[model samples]
Target: MATNRLLRTAGTVLTATALLLSGCSSGDSSPGAAASGQPTNGRTGSADTMPEAATATIKPLPTAVPAALRPYYGQKLTWRECGIVGFECTTMKAPLDYAKPSTATDLKLAVSRKKATGPGSRIGSLMVNPGGPGGSAIDYLQQYAPQPDAVRARYDMVAMDPRGVARSEPVTCLSSAQMDGYTRVDQTPDSDAEVDRLTSALRDFTRGCRARTGARLGHVSTAESARDMDVLRAVLGDDKLTYVGASYGTFLGATYAGLFPSRVGRLVLDGATDPSLPARTMNRDQTAGFNTAFTAFAKDCAKQRDCPLGTGSPEEAGRRLTALFKQLDARPAPTGSDRTLTESLATSGVTAAMYDEGAWPVLREYLAKAQKGDGSGLLALSDSYYERDPDGTYANQMFANPAVNCLDLPGAFSGPDEVRAALPAFRKASPVFGESFAWAALNCAYWPVKPTGEPHRITAEGAAPILVVGTTRDPATPYPWARALASQLSSATLLTYEGDGHTAYGRGSDCIDTTINTYLLEGTPPPPDKHCT
Candidate 1:
């Protein structure tokens, strides 16, 4: 998951309250109110008053199964020509709406597997999810994940694109050109007119998605995606679902464990997000986490000889960077090409570089260029964050991002007035990030579909022990979220990676890699509170 600006300045209680209140309008009810089926004080419509349904019950295993079930369930999938060597691709069908299971809406899920290459006994499929809620797991598998020998040796490595994401039924909202317009919309609204413009952009974005893809939009909730995973598990014939999830994928994995506790096996959640937090709180914590990561970057940049910012101290470096952002905000910088980099793009570029230490040097170089009035490097970083291609085409991240995130949790703020009231608090939490991110929270405010779930604990009481990995200086999923989630789960072991970057496993920490690999291969959970430097 990329660092979202909306969550960076969510620490103010008054702002959160105002945002909540603004959600309740006499003429219009926000999706959060409607989907929650909670009462809105000002709204008279019954749409917001629907009774909460009983939690979906998982059925007992059937004694007799059909012949078709045999091949998928407990059958070893043979690897064949899947474009990539040693990898095979297969499709599994899941109900589009879990609530209407008997209905005939089959969502196709793309699955990939690389057979175990070890002399030891082969474990079942070990699934992986890179956090995006919108991130392509198959891309992650083919690119970064499968190279890990220790993991591939013992288990058949697998990755599936969740429904409405890539390789699955992709949910697209804007065309490439429209997306460019949307991305360029000023995120930092300084005046009432600017706030209205921001809101209009958000509403227009949501409306565009609804217009482009209406039927599939409402069905992309996390709960529905979790059910799809269970279907994948059954088709793969794994008695238990062994998996690894990072960032937002942790929430997906944890939800799966919660929904089907009896079927969980050797699950590992890295850079975990706490499922028990409200959107506002989660946003605030993430804001602080990014600031923490920025401080770390500043410290390192100060030591570099080519550092664009002054080398006196990290704080001084941060001040210089902040001043640079403000300068860009006032007068955007020109790239060699026709494109110019705005403050939002510059901030996004900086945020993208914060994801991995490997990118820090590149970021410093870009900062130096930007300081010299060249914006190409920073623009390139922002383009990567947006997943924009050379042809100006985009992956479905921006569109599918809100489709999944809004459904997973309610919005943080509801209106411009609320945002204005919360500005002071947001500014205090993240002076560098507050305005842009606090406005980013508005993305969900105009979502066409309402959220289907709320923040909740996922104990999965009877499930096997699950390993939760947290990076000490992770910019996306804060370490404390990992701690909070581990504490919430009944059978969870917290593994701490005292390091930088978004996730821990396979990122160079021998302690983290070895521990997670052993557990995946041998079914032994890492020791509780195990710290890896």
Candidate 2:
């Protein structure tokens, strides 16, 4: 099971939920900046000056490619039709340890692309990544890509699964059965024995990851993946990268821009994550974000008929939901299957629905069912969140999520005592989901690999204007992160969507879509103060 700090894309969550019903499935510290619907730090200059200023400010890449890295960068991609009709897939090579490059140490990475259906000149590849630190970029590209026809007509859409993620030498830990049990393990433990069991499960998970994944475990950091993206950029014949990254992908994109500022071209970071926060702060803030999202859901639910938590204030709704969680904790609810819905899974189910408001109605139904001693609906939602197929198998995302997160930064808490110490604040941030998210944040503490990166700001100086998009009530990445990231990047223009869900683009907002599509097509970012409802 991945930590609750997981930065998931809205489309991926909503899309997975759609399949499951059918039968399948941050950090900024600025006063008033995080919660505000409006952009915080405004970009200088008027709208007319924005386009030229953005294009002209970009720094040129060095003329020569590093001699040591040229072979990896210059290697040809032999694309073949990979089942999906219009999509082509290929494997690209990257040095496992960039510090030491050789054929013996090469790692094969999966790359996929759909060539432009053009009436206009090609505008290079529009690379995309849909968060997860572990979510498959190739899978996301297949499911949701080339969203705008005009943009698709002018650019080849491309995606590369980052190292240790889906299709790119994935990290696998638990078996299907192990994962099933792992997911059901009580995250919000009450007794000392339960706490020990939870900690034991985490230790075993980390051990399995270390035992199953060897040296490659140490090489899956976002920095390494960012470097791999540069190689992909060179191989694709693009002097600069034009890209869209959502959720954790925002962090990946920001890392790329920071690492290779001169090569950034028309980058879009929607549902932005703040790279400046430590693991603890990120997890805690995400807890608060979920609180904000659920409050929105509760308010909407209260106005509807047969609302599970009744038509009262959000606090009342939260209390009713909390009572349901307690009931499950004591006596697991039957889901018609052998796997009963424990409080942990129940929490995950509700948390999953909080990602996109489209799932709100479904959440209401599931909560109603759970109240009546039926947990199947909520279990399905949790299964979708974990990407567990009907066959009981699981995706590699859960494994890769921690592998990358633990390496990216230190653990949120070192031990159970620390978690207990921190629970008050976590609960204060989120009265309902806080305790579970707080304990979930402990997954990285047991990781075998020590962290290679730490909390820091990403300036991405001299990078061509990067659009930092945020949704006000975004559960995963939160709105304020967009503000913080925009302020950090020297050339970023903050675009706000005063709405619900994880991301703004393609989520029924013409304003958000037009602003992003225009920027990608014409390199003209919306004014920094732009906020759409």
Candidate 3:
């Protein structure tokens, strides 16, 4: 029920996808190479130019450490067995405010790793982040333990929960009951009264964050988290950083490359986000991306015998779904509990399935049930999307999501007026999802803290060859964003996955897996024109 524009990873979505569909991986590794997969034509720059560009443009920091940061950069980390069978957990300290490194306040960040099971010599650490800006890298490591065998054979698999994420001192704000009410609030307002209610909700949400999070609210920007990562790299004893970042993590990785280009080893940015676009534009584009994904689902649903969307064309299917949403807006369907599936929650449930094609069947079943007045299935999907537990407690993600998003860039709109002004364009982008998303973008406008960062191109000119992987039908981070990020990074090689999903690396594409695996192992990037299905 947070802003729909958060470039979240497919961790929960993948889990739901796995339950409904077969052939899904456990988020750990991918199936082997697909012999039949082939590449399409189109080239950017020569892959051969990457090494030279990285070397020639490299601008490293001075050998002498800054006096203020030495303590953090030099501190030792104590790793101990925790979480699961194979993972080791540790904590590292970072200045609460990088600009005021001498301040007494500090943050203790959580980190986890699984040692390399090498038949070959160890090749340093390969850190991983699964987007969310709020996603717990430590949790991601635990869930996706034991990376691909080839990569695991060489590098130590590591993950550090960013400054204010799970395990770290997370940015907590809302209580479970408050969050339940927040999620059910109408996202698509009609009358001016409804608009006022939506604006008041955002204001209240911001007030809660300011009251609960305090001074740290202003310090949780993506740029600061990138700095934390560098200190982490230094303490881990890695001369250069090798990483795999997905969705919003790509932005984090790219920021690191831009800030410390000389220290980039081999970074794979999957489901890349474009740092050059303003917040509003990014939200608008994501609206269209979900529409593209939903269209695909509609087409697939039409082929089914009991398709709830009916045996109509994809366009017709969308119309039927849209009608259902409007009906829910007027009369929310009951979910057997005190809670009901309102238009906003119903829309969230449908959009959640757009993250991967595997959830299409589940969507069909839920849509059927919702039409028959049994909204429980759709409510469950909404719960999954929001990471809400049956006990009614919520994860810190929804809270941290807005905290980082609001501070990373200026809000998409300053007031409800701006959102109303942009509604036409949003609706044009996604006939079904656009208006709701347009209103969702207003959540950040009432932030108590002003943004510290802005839209700008990040050309990590001196970084080693970085891989930017994009899924053509990625619902969260659109395909064009990947292309845009790849183009922005001087040493990047774009790897295209002509598939349907939020990311490419471990989503069952042999061509994508093989190309990325080869790069992680041999330090060779896929050709700039590389495309796979």
What is the alpha-carbon lDDT for the whole of candidate 2?
Answer: 0.77
Please report, as a residue range, the 10-residue window in candidate 1 with the lowest summed lDDT: 12-21
Root mean square deviation (Cα) for candidate 1: 7.4
Q: Estimate each model's TM-score.
A: 0.86, 0.90, 0.90
Q: What is the lDDT of residue 395 in candidate 1?
A: 85
Instruction: Quantify all predictions' global Cα lDDT against the true fold.
Output: 0.69, 0.77, 0.75
Q: Per-residue lDDT tens digits of candidate 1, residues 205-286?
A: 7898898877788877766676667777777768889988877778778878876778889898888887665565556556
Instruction: Report clash pairs, candidate 3.
Output: none
Write one digit per residue (lDDT tens) for candidate 2, span 259-368. Answer: 68889999998888877655676677778898999999999999999799999999999999999999999999999998899898888888888888888888898899
Error of 3 at 531 (Å): 0.5
- In model 2, what is the error at residue 101, expressed in angstroms? 1.3
| TM-score, predicted candidate 3 vs. hidden true structure | 0.90
